[model samples]
Target: MTFLKPVLKSILLTLLIAFTASLNAQTHSKNGMVVSSDKSSSAVGAAILKKGGNAIDAAIATAFSLAVTHPSAGNIGGGGFIVFMNSEGKTTTIDFREKAPLSATNDMYLDQEGKLIDGINHFSAKAIGVPGTVAGLFLAHEKYGKLPWKDLLQPAIDQAKNGFAFNWSLYNAANYFTKEGNTNPFMDSYFRNESGGVTQPDEIWKQTELAETLIRIRDKGRDGFYKGKTAKMIASFMKKNDGIITKKDLAKYEAIERQPIKGSYKGYDIYSMPPPSSGGVALVEMMNLMELADLKTMEFNSSEHLHLVAEAMRRAFADRAEHLGDPDFNLNIPLDKLTSKEFAKKRFQGIDMTRASVSDSTKYGRLYDGENTTHLSTMDKDGNAVSLTYTLEYSFGSQMGSKELGFIFNNEMGDFNPQPGITKSNGQIGTAPNLVEPEKRMLSSMTPTIVGKNGKPYLVIGSPGGRTIINTVFQTVLNVLEFEMPVNKAIEALKIHHQWLPDQIVYEKYLLSPDTKKSLEAKGHTLKERNNMGALMGITYDPEKKIFTGASDSSQPDSGAVGY
Candidate 1:
C-alpha cells in the first residue's frame, strides 16, 4: 500500500501539470477574457475572472504572474501605466512609471568631454530607475480590486515556488543573455541551470528567491517591496554595483492616480495615460487629426490612406517630443491645446496630401525610445476593462538581475535624454523636456488605452513597442472604429509607424505592395522594412449583442486571448 501511494502521488502531479497546460489551450468565452504576451499569465487572469473577480483583479493577477513566467519584459523591477474603466463608465489611470533616483543627474550618462558614454546608459547599474511596479499594483488593488490581495498573487507565487515548464522564448532569451560574450554578469547566474547552461525546453524551472519575495509582498502588500527586506536587498545591490537607488528612494516611491488624457474620435470617447508617458497625448492628438480626414473613403492600406495616416503620425510625434514629459517636472505641457480638436485642425492644415512630411528635428524637440515591453488587456462581464503596459526597458532590462531578489532591474533611466541638447540623426535625442531630474519619471511610449461608446467600453487595447506604441494603439482603434473591422481582424491587419524623426516610414514587410512602395517613394517617403511592430493585446465589446471579442498579436509566440 505504501508503494502504491508513491505511484498515485506521481500520477496526481502529472495531472496537475496537464490541467495547467489545458488552461492555455482554451481561447474563447462569453463572460470574461484576458489577452497578454504569455500563455500562463493569460491563464491566471482568466482564472481570476472566472472566480468572479473584476477586470482590475484579473489584471493584477496577470501582471504578477507574468513577472514569474514572462521574465523578458514583465517585471517587479519595472514600472508602467494602467488605464481603467469601471462598469459605470468612470475612467482613471495609474502612473507607476519608474523615476530617476535622487542621486541621478541630467548629465550622468555623459563623459567629461560632454559626449554620451557608449552603452553606460543601457548596460550599467546607473541605468536603473527606482521601480514603481509593486507600489502601482498595490494602489490599484487597494482602490479597485474585489478579491483579497493575497489571493491575486498566489498563482504567481505558486509558479515561482513549485516551478513551471521552460519554453522556447524563455530559452532563447536565456541563451542570448548567458552567452560568453554578454556583458551582464548577473544574467548567467540567474538564468542558467546548476550545470551552467540554459534550461532546456519543457524543463521545470523554479525561482526560490523570487517566490520568497512574492510571499513578502503577499503578506505585507506594498511594504514588502518598497521597505524592509526586499528594499534592503535592492539598496544593498545598488550600493555594491554603482547603481544609484537607495532605501530612501524606494521608500519614497508612490504610484500616482491621475486623470486619464481624454479625447473623442468620431463620437467615441478615448481614455489613456497622461505625461511621463507620451503615449496617451500623442495618441489622442493623432486620433483628433485622423478624425478630420475622411479615412473611410480611402481603400485600406492604399498608398493614399497610408500617406494620410503617416502625415498625422509625423505631426503628432513631433509635438510629443517637443511638449511631452513627466507632468510634475514640466508644468507647462499645454495638455488642453494638444488634445483639442482645434489644435488638430491647425496641425492638419499643414499637411500636403501629395507628399510625405519630412521629419525635421530642428523644428520638433527630438525623438528616441526603446522596443521591449509587455502589455495585457482584461475585460470582465460586469463591464469593467483594464489596459496595462509595463516593461524592464531593453529586453531583459540591463540584462541584470539581483541574486538575492531574483528579479531584473529596469534600465529605464536610459529613456531620459542623456545629453542636454544633442539631438542626433542616429536616433539619439537630448531634449529639454525629457532631461533627467531627481525623482522625475522618464518619458515613455507605453500607450495603454480604452475606447468608450455610449457610456460603455468599446475597445480596450495597448502594446509594447517603445516608440511605435502610440501608432500601434492608434491603428488598432482606427481599424475597429473607422474601418469597422472585428477585433481579431483589426489586430491581424498590417501596421505602420513613422515617429517624426528618422523621416522614414517603418512598415511590416508585406504591408506595402511594389506599386504602393513606389508611390510612397515618389511622394518623398523613405520606406524601411521591419519584420514586425508592437505586439498588441486587445478586447472589444458589442453593446447591442452584449458580446466580448479579444485577440493577441499574431507575431507573439505563446501569446493568447484566454476567456471563460
Candidate 2:
C-alpha cells in the first residue's frame, strides 16, 4: 500500500505535468526565439524560421510538430488561439477554439433527473467537439504565412514517419494513460514499443499512421482532413460508438479571424484572444488593478504584492464567471466596458486590501464571465511575433480517437457547466455563461498573449494549466512589464493563483514563504499548497539592443528554447 501510494503520486504528478506547469524547461537561444513545451517542436519551429519562414510560418510549423511530439497538449484533434503581431506593429488574433457539434444541446450532459452526468461530459464519445486546428492553421497561413503550407507541415510529417527520440514528456503521458486503467485504440498504437515495454529515452519512436495523415493534409489542404477520407472515418467511428458527430458537423467548422482584445499596462500594449476566450478580458481587468497599486515600492514575494495579485485574480475571475461566454451565443457581454480603465477602477475599489473577499461576497449583477492547452512563443528576424496556445482540453483529451485519423479527439465539452442552473455546495450562486449550445464554442482559460512596447513586440507569453492558465500568464506579464525583470527571471519566479471559487489561495509548494502564508492567513485568506502550477513558455525582446531572451520555466526542465 505504501508503494502504491508513491506510484499513485508519481502517476498523478505525471498527469499534472502532462496537463499543466509540470513540463521541463530545456533552454537555449540567441537572436530570434522559439520556446515550447517540447524540444523537438521548438527545434522544428526554429528550423523553419532559419529557412526564411516568418513568425506565422514558424508558429504553424511548431504547432504541427507539437501535434506529433507533444500530443498530450499540442494537438490537431483540438483547437486553440493565436496572437500574432507583424513588423508593422499590427496584431491580429485567430480564434480557432473548438465549437460544439450541431448535434449537441445544452442538456446533453444531463440525465433524466436533470443531474450532471460525469463520464458523459468528460471522456465519453459525447465529449468530442467539431475540431478547428486544420482550418485555423490554413487561415493563419493564408493571411500571414510565408513558407508554403506543405513545407510547414512536412517537418512534422517527416518527424512522425522517420521517428524522433522518445522524450520524458511523452514517456510520462504514456504512463498516465496506461496507469490510469484507461485504454484508447490510438493510445495503444501511439505509445507502444516493438518489445512491449515503455518507449525509452534515446530510442526512436515513429508514428507512421500519423505521418500518412499529415501527408494527406499537406497534399489536400483543409479538405484533406475535414471533408474527405478523414471525415468519413470520424463519422463512422462516432456512429459505431454512440457519438453524435456527423460529417456535416466537421464540414461546417471554420476558424475565425477575430480582432485582438487590446489593453495597456505601464505603456506596454497587450493583445490577446477575445470573447470565447476569456483570457484577454481577465488579463486586462487584473492589469488595470495592478496599474493602480504602487507595486514598485513593494518587494517581490512580499505579502502586500501577493494580496494585491490575489484580490485582482479574485475580482477578474468573478467578472469572468458573471459575463464571459461565446460572444456569438451570449450577445450582450460588455466587451468594451469590462475592459476599460474606469470599470477596472470600479472593480478595484471593491477589494479590501486588509482582508480576503471570499466568493460569497463577490458580486455580479453588472458583470461577465469568460486548458489542457500547450503554448509556444515565436519571433522571426523580421520582427513578426506569435504567441499561440493549443490544446486537447485535457490530458490526452477525451482519451478517444479516430483509428484512421491517428490523432486524439478533444473532450472539450467538459469545459461547459453541466446543468447550467444547478447550485454548487458553496453558498455563491454560480453563473453559467459558458453552458453548451449547438454550434457554440465552450469557454476556455487559455491566454495566448503578446505585449507591445513603443509599437513593437516587447513580450510573448502563454501557458497550459487548465484553470490556472490565466493567472500564470498574468503574473509573468507583471514580472516583466511592471517589475522590470528579465524574461528568464520573469518566468522562473514563484507563482500563485486564486480562481474565485474554491476560496483557497493555491501557491507553489516551498515557493511561497512561511511569512507570506502567515500574513495571508491573518488577512483571512485560506491557503492550499501545490507542487506545481503551469508550463509558462515566453520570450521577451529588447528593441533598443535588438536582443531577445526566451525561457521555458523551471517547472518543466526539458522545455526547449531555440534561436538562430
Candidate 3:
C-alpha cells in the first residue's frame, strides 16, 4: 500500500506540472478583440475597445502602453509600418520607416580605404536616423481614431509614472544595460538610482522622465516632441554621441501614407505595406510562388513540405535583395510586376524540386534590407482590423538612451547599404538600391499583413525577427489557411527560415528530429539549429459564428490576448 501511494503521488505531481505549463503557454479571451506580445498592453487595448474605441484607437493605446510595459521592442524611439483594414474592406498602409539624417553620406560607415568599419553602422550616435513613431501614431489617431488622442496616451503615461511590477524581461533588460559598451543614461536612470545603485527585479521601475514626455505629447500633439525641448535634447544627445541627427531633422520628420501592396492567395486577398518595407512584395511573391505547388497535398512539417517552402523563401529573398527598395530612391521597383502571378510562376519554374539551390551576393536583380521589431493585432466589434509593427532596430535600441527625452533611439542606418554593389574587404556585398541618401527611407522587412475572404478580414498577422519576419508570417498564414489549423496551433507549429545569402536553413532546435534533419540534408540543404527565430502574434475571426479568436506566440511568456 505504501509503494502504491508513492507511485500515485508521483503521477499527480507530473499531471499538475503539465497542466500548469499548458495554462502558462496560452491565454483565451472570451471576447478575442485584442492581442499583444505583452499582457498589460493587451489589457489596455481591450479596455479601449470596451470603451467604444475603434481598432486604430485600441492599437494606439496599446502602442503607448507597450512603451512602458514591453520596453524591449514596444517603443516611441523607433519607427515602423501600419496596415489597417476597415469593416467596409478598404485598406491603407502607413510608411513610417526611419530616414537617414540630411547630413548622412553614402560612405558614412566606410573607412578611407573604402572598407566597411566594424560596428560603425550599428553603434554610437552616427547610426541614428530620424524617428517616426510619434508622428505616425498621431496621424493614425487624427484620421481614424474615435477616442481623443490624449485619452490614448493617458494610460501609458500613468503606467510609466505609477510603475508596474518588474518582470523577467525587464530584469534581462537591466542585465543588458549593465554590460560594458551597453550603457545608456536613460536606461540607467530607470534601472539604477541617482545614488548609482541598481534596483532588484521585485522593485518598481518608474520612468518619471518618460511619463513627463508622454504628458507633453498628449497636451501639445506631435509638435511636443518634434519642436520643443524634446527635440533640442535629442539634438544635444546626437552632438554628444557623434550622431548626426539635428533639430531640423526632427522638425522635418513626417509619416507618409502609402497605398497598400495587394496580393491574392488561393482565393483570399492579402494586404501589406509597400517599400521601403521589403515585407509586402516578398510576402506577396512567396505566396504566388507557393501557389505553384500543391502544398495541401503534402504532410505538414514533413521534409517534403519544408523543402518546397524553403526554396520559395530563398527565391523570394533573392528577389528582395535584387529588386525591392524605397520608391523615392529607386524609381523602378517593379512592385506590380514583381508580385504578379506570372512573375511568381516564372520564378517558381526555376526551382528544382528534388534539390536545394545556391545563392550569392551578386544574386539580387538590382535591389533591397532586416530589423529587430515588435507587432500586435487588434479587431473591434465592427470588424475593422489593424496589424501594427514597430521597432527600435536592436534590443534596447543602440543600447543608448536619452537622459532628457527619456526614450531610446534606433540604429536604423544599419539597414542601408554602406557600399554600392561592391563586396568590400569584409566579404560583404552592398545593397545599392537601399543605400543611404539625403532624406532617404532605409529599407525594412517589417511586414504587417491582413488576410481576408471576399473583402472581409478573417486574419491579422505579423512578427519581429529581423530578416526572418517574412518567413514567420508566411508559415503562420500557411498553417492556418492551407492546413486548416486553428489560430493557436498555427502560431505553435515549428517554423523554418532560409535567406538566399546564407544558403542555410535555420530551424527551431526543438522542432526537428534526427530523421527530419537527415532527410533534409540528403536533399542538399545546409541545416542549422537555432534556439528560436520569430515572435509571431496573430488574431483570427470566424465570420459564420461572428466570433474573434486571438493568440500570441506561446514562446513569449508575457504574451497576452484579451477580448470584451
Candidate 4:
C-alpha cells in the first residue's frame, strides 16, 4: 500500500507539470481580437482594443508599452519601417530609419592601423544614429489613427509610472544582457537593484523617468521629444559620450511617407516596405521568381520545395548585397529591372533542378544602384489597416541609457560598412551606399507586409531579426498563400534562411529531415543547423465572415493574438 501511494504521487506531479506547461504555451483570449508579444505588452495592446481603439491605435499603444516593458527589443531611441493597407485599398510605406550624424564621415571607425575595432565602432555613442521611432509612430497616428495622441500614449505612460511585476522571461532576457559581457553602465543601473544584480520574476520595476518623458510627449506632441527637453537631454548625452548627434539632427528629422513596394503572387497583391529598407524589394523579387513555379502542389518542406526556396533566397540576397541601398543617396534603383518578369525568369534559370547554385555564381541582371527599424499591424472598423515595425537595432540599442530620459540610444551606426575605401562621390567616406551619413537613413531588413486578395486586405504580417527579416516574412506569406496552411500552424512551422555571406543554408533543426539534409548535401548545398530562427507576428482577415484571426510565433516566450 505504501509503495503504491508513492507511485501515485509521482504520476500526479508529472501530470501537473505537463498541464501547466500546456497552459503557458496556449494563448489567453478576449472578445474577437488578439494581441501577441512577450506578456505585459500583449495584455496592454488587448486592453487598448477593448477601450474602443482600432488596430493602429492598439498597435501604437502596444509599441509604447513594449518600449518600456520589453526594453530589450523595443525603444524610442531607434528607427524602423511601416507598411499599411487602409480599407480603401490604398497602401503606403513610412520610412523612419535612423540617420547618421552629420559629423559622421565614411571612415570614422577606421583607426590609424585601419583595422575595424569591434567594440569601439559598435558600442560607442559615435555608433548611435539619429532616432526616428517617435516620428514614425506620430506619422502613423496622424494618418490612420482614430484615437487621440494623448489617449494612445497614456497606457504606456501609466505602465511605466506604476511599476509592473517582472516575469521569468524578462529575468532571462536580462540575464542574457549580463552574460553578453557588454552591459552598458546605464542598463546595469535600470536592470539591477541596489545590489547590482538582475531582478527576478515578481520583482517590481518602475520606470519613473520614462513615464515622465511619455507624459511630456503626450502633452507636447512629437515636438516634445525632438525639439524640447527630451531632445536636449539626448543631445547632451551624445555630446558627453563623444557622439555626433546635435539639436539640428533632432529638429530636422522627419518620417517620410512613401508608396509601399507592390508585387503580385498567385493573384494576391503584396505590399511591403520600400528602399532604405532592402526587405520590400528583396521580398518582391523572391516572390516574382517563385511565381514561375507551381509551388501550391509541392509538399510543404519537401526537399525539392525547400531547396528551391533556399536557392531563391540566395539569388535575391546576392542582388541585395550588390545593388540595394538608400534611394535618396544612390542612383535611382532600376526597380523595373529587378521585379520584371524577364528578370525573374533569368534569375530562375540559374537554379538547377537537382542542386543548389554556388553563392557567387547566382547573377542578378543590370542594376544601377540603390537601399526593423518591429512591425505592428492595425485595422479599424472603418476598414483602415496599418502595419508598423520599430526597433533600436540590437537589444537596447547602443546600450547608452539616459538617466533623465530613462531610455536607451540606438547603435545603428554599426550597421554602416566601416571599411575605409567605401566612399560616395559627394566626399562622403565610409558611405557604402548603405553606410552612415548625417541625416541619411541607415538601411534595414524590416519587411512589414500586407497581402490583399480580390482588392481587399487579407494578411498583415512582419518579423524581427537583424538580417532574417525578409526570409521570415517571405516564408510565412508563402505558408498561407502557397502552402495553404492555417495562420497559426504556418507560424509554428520550422523555417530556413540563406543570406549568401555565410555561404550556408541555416534551418531550424525540427524543420529539416535527415533525408532532406542528405539530399541537399548531395546536391552540393552547404547545410548548417540552428535551433531557433526568428519571431513573427501576423493577422489574417476573413472577408466572408469579417473576422480577424491573429497568430504570433511560439519561438518567443510571449506572443499571441486576441480577437473580439
Candidate 5:
C-alpha cells in the first residue's frame, strides 16, 4: 500500500505540470484578439477593454505602459503622429511631432570644416525635442477615451514604481547599448549594476523618477509635465547639456490636428499619417502605382511580383528623395504634383518587367529637403483606431542626458544637411529633406495606417524602422489585402525593400526564395541580404464574429497582443 501511495503522488505531480503548461500555452497563444509590441502593454490595453473603455482608451493605456516598460523604443521623451478612425466613420490625424528647439539651426551637426560629425546622438539632451507623448496621450483620451484619465495612466505609474522584470529582449538591447559607438552614458547606470554586468531576467527595475513624473501628470494633468516642475527640470537639463530646449519651448508646444492622407486599393480605403511624415504620401503613392499592375494574380514571392514591388518602391523613393519635407517649411515639395495620377503614370512607365532602373535615369522630377522622426499605432473595440509615429532622429538621441532628469535627449539636429545652399533656416532644406529649424517638426517615415473594408475599418497597423518603414507597411498591407493571408502570416511574410539611391534591394533571408533571389540577380537587381527589417503591430477585425485579431512582428522579442 505504501508503494502504491508513492506512485499515486508521482502521477499527481505529472498531472499538475501538464495542467500548468497547457494554461501557459493558452495564455500565450497567437490567436488572442489584441496584439502589441509588449505583452504587458497588451495586458494594459486588455484592462482598458475590460473596464468598458473603447479601443482608443485601450490604445492610450497600452501606449503609456509602453513608455514605461519599453523605453528603449517606446518613450515619453519623444514625439509621434496618430491616425484615428471613429465609429461614426470620421477619421482624424493627430500630429504630436517633436518640435525643433528654438536654438536649433540647419547646420548644428556640421563641424567647422562642413563635414557632418556623427555628433548627433538620439540619446542626448541636445537631441531631445519638445516631448509630445504626454500631450498626445492626453489629447486622445480627452477626445475619445471613456475611462478616467487617471485610470489610463495609473497602470503605467504602477508599473514604473513597482518595477518590471528584465527579459531576454531588454537584456539583449542593453547589451547592444554597451557597444562603443552607442552614446548615452546614463544607460550604463540604468541598465547595469555596480559590477557592469547586465541585469538578469526577473530582476526588478524601477524608474522612480519617471514614476513621479507620470504621477504628477496623472494628478495635475498635462500641465504638470509641460508647464510645471517637470518642464522646468527638462529645461534645466537641456541648458546644462548644451541643448537649446527651454521652458518656453515646452510651454509653447502644441499637438496639431491635421487631415489624414487617404488612398484606395482593392476596394479598401487606407488612412495613414500625413506630412511631416512622408509615410502616408509615399505609401499612397506606392500603392497607387502598384494598383496599375496585376499584383494579386502574381504568385506570392514570385520573381515577377518581387520585381514589380521593388520597382514601385524605387520610383516612390525617388519621389521621396526628390520632393518630400515638412510642408510648413518647404515650398518646393509639390505635394499635389507628386501624388497626382499623371506623375504616378509617368513614373510607372519606367518599370521594365525584368530589370531595375538606373537612379539618375529615373527622372523623378526635382529635389527638396530636410529632417528625422519615429511612429506607433493603436485601436480599440468601438471601431476607433489610432496609428502614431515619432522619433528623436538617431538611436539614443543627442548622446546627452539631463543628469537631473534621468533621461536622454534627441539628436534630431543631424536630420539637417550641412552642405550650404542645401538647407534653409526655417526648416526648408533642399538636399536633406529632414533639416532642423526653430519650432519646426522634422520629416519622418513613420507610417501608422488603418485600412477599411465595406466602408468600415478593418485593419489598424504601423511599424518602427527609419526609411524602411514605408516599404514594410506597404508590403504587409499587400500580403493581407492582395495575398489573402491571415494576420499573423501576413506579418510573418518576408519583407523586401529598395530605396533607389542604395541601388540595392534588401531582403530578409527568411523571405528570399533561392529561385527568386537568383532571378532578381539575373535581372540586374543588386540584392543585399539582412536578418530583419522592422517591428510591426496590428489588429484586424474578424467580421463574422465581430472580434478583433491582433498580430505583432516576430522580429521583436517582447511585442505581442492581448484581449479580454
Candidate 6:
C-alpha cells in the first residue's frame, strides 16, 4: 500500500505541473488582447485598448513601447510591414520596408576588384537605410486608429524619459555589448550608467534623447522624424561617418498601402503582406502545397508529417528566391501564379515522398536575411485585428547610430545581394532581383499575417526570424488551423526551417526524436539543430464563444499576453 501511494503522488505531481504549464502558455479575455515579446510593451498595448483604442491604436502604441523597451529589433530607424483586418473582414496591408539611400549603387558592397568586402556591407554606417517605421505607424493611425496620436506616443516617451526597470535580459545584453573587447561606442554611451558600466539589473535606465525624438514625432507627426531636428541630426551623423543617406532621402520616404495577398486554405482565408516582403508569397505557396496532403490524418511532428512540410518549404523557398522581390523594382514578379493552387499542385507533383529533393544553388537565390527582429499581435473588442513585425536587420543593427538621437541604425541594406551574379554554396546569393539600387526597397521575409474564418478574424499571428519567418508562421498556422491545437500549444510547438539554398533542414533543438531523425536521414534529408527558431506573438479568437486567446512564445523570457 505504501509503494502504491508513492507512485500515485508522482503521477499527481506530473499532472499538476502540466496543468500549470498550460495555464501559463495562454490567457483568455472576453474583450481585447495584446501579445508581444515584452511584458511592458504588451501591457502598454492593453492599456490603450482599455482606454477605448482600437486594434490599430494598440498596435501603434505597442510598436513605440517596444522601441523603448525592446530595442534590439523594435526601432524608429528600421522598417517593417503590417497586415490589418477591420471588423467587417475587409483587409489591407502596409509596406514600410526601408529603402536604399539614393546614393546606393548596385556594386556598393563590392570592392574595386568586384569582390565582396567582408563586414563592410553590414557593419558600417553605409548599411543604414532610410527608415520608414515612423511613416508606417503614422499612416496606419491616420487611416484606422481610434486614439489620438499624442496619447499613443506618450507611454513610450514616458518610459524613455522617466526610465523603466532594467531587467536581467536588458542588463545582460548591455553588459555583453559593453564588454572590453566587444564594446560598441554608441551602445556603451547610451545603454550604460554614468559610471561607465553596464546598467545593473533593476536599475532605472532612462534615455532622454530617445524621449525627445519621440516627442518630435508626437507633435509634428511624420515630419517630426523626416524634416525637423531629428532629420538634420541623422543626416549630419551619416555624412560625418562616411555614409550616403541625406536629408533628401529622409524627406522623400513614404509608406505605401499595398493590397494584401489573399489565399484560402481548407476553407479559411489567409491574408498577408505583399512584396517587398517575401513572407506572404512564400507562406501562401507553402500552405497551398500542404493543402494537397491530408495533414489532419498525419501524426503531429512525425517523420512523414515533417517530411512533407519540409519538402513544401524547400519548394516554396526556391520559388521565393527565383520570383519574388521588391514590387516597385521588379514589376514582373508572378505573384498571382506563385500563390495559386494550380501552381502549388505543379510544385507538389515534384515532391518525392521517399527522398528529399536536391537543392541546387544554381537554380535558387541565396537567403541573405538576418534573424533578429520582433513581432506583435493586437485585437480589439470591435473585432479589428493587426499583426505587425519589424526589425533592425540584426541584433542592435549596425551597432551604430547618432549618440544625440539615441537610436540604432538599421543594417537593412545588408539584405540586398552584395555581389551580383555570384551564388555561393555557403548560402550567399547574388541574385539580380535583390541587388541594391537607388531608392529601392530591399527584399525581406518578415511575415505578419491574419487568418479569417466566416468573414471574421480567426487569428492574428507573426514572428521575427528573418529567412525563417515564413516557415515559422506557416507552422503556427498549420498547428492551429490544420491540427486543431490550442492557441498556446500552437505557439510552443517545435518548428523547423528549410531555406532551399542550403538544402538542409534546421530543426529546433530536440524537436525530432532519434528515430524520427534517423527516418528523415534515411530519406536523404540533411538535418541541423538550432537552439530555437522564432519568438512568436499570436492571438486566436473563438467566434462561437466570443473569447480571445492570446499567446506569447515562452522561449522569450519577457514575452507576455495582456488583456482587458
Best lDDT goes to which candidate?
6
250-353 in candidate 1: lDDT tens per residue?
99999999999999988899999999899989989999888899876888999998998888888888888788899998999989999999988888888898
TM-score of each predicted structure versus truth: 0.94, 0.92, 0.93, 0.90, 0.87, 0.95
lDDT of each model, Cα atoms only? 0.89, 0.84, 0.83, 0.75, 0.72, 0.90
How many clashes in each structure?
0, 25, 6, 27, 43, 0
What C-alpha RMSD separates each model from the true structure? 9.1, 5.0, 4.0, 5.6, 8.2, 3.5
Query: Per-residue lDDT for 1-564 in model 3, tens only?
Result: 988997997788668546534643534444447778788889999999988999999999999899888877788888999999999899998888888999989888888998878998888778887988999999898888999988899999998888877778777777777667854556656576435666567677677888999999999989988888888888888888788989999999999999999998888999998999989998998899888898768877888889889988888887887777789889988898889999887888788878887766664533223446889999998989999999988876776767656678888888888777674322244767888898999888898999988889889999998888989999888888778887777886788988787778999875676787898999999988987777888888888788888878766778878888
How does model 6 fare in lDDT?
A: 0.90
Give one digit per residue, the lDDT tens place, for model 2 in 451-495.
998999889999999879999899999998888887767776788
lDDT of 4 by residue, 1-564 (tens): 988997997788568545533433423232334444655676677777778877677778888888887776678888888777767788887898888877887668878787666676568888888888889889988987777999989888988888788877778767766666754667667677435668778888788899989998899888989988999998898889888899998998899998778999979999988888888888999998889988767777888888888888887776776667778888777777776778899888778869777654223222111012355555555555667677777767777878899888888887766774543322122425676566777777888889998887788888887788889889998888887777766776768888765567888864577898898788888888987566777777777667777677766665556554
Query: What TM-score does candidate 1 reach?
Result: 0.94
Minimal lDDT window, size 10, model 5: 23-32
Q: How far is 96's C-alpha from truth in model 1 (Å)?
A: 0.4
lDDT of each residue in 362-424, candidate 6, tens digit only: 866232178899999999998999999999999888889987898898999999988999987
Q: Which pairs of residues have clashing backbones in candidate 1?
A: none
Best by TM-score: 6
> Which segments of model 3 are wrong by more than 4 Å?
1-32, 179-186, 193-196, 365-371, 423-429
Error of 3 at 348 (Å): 1.2
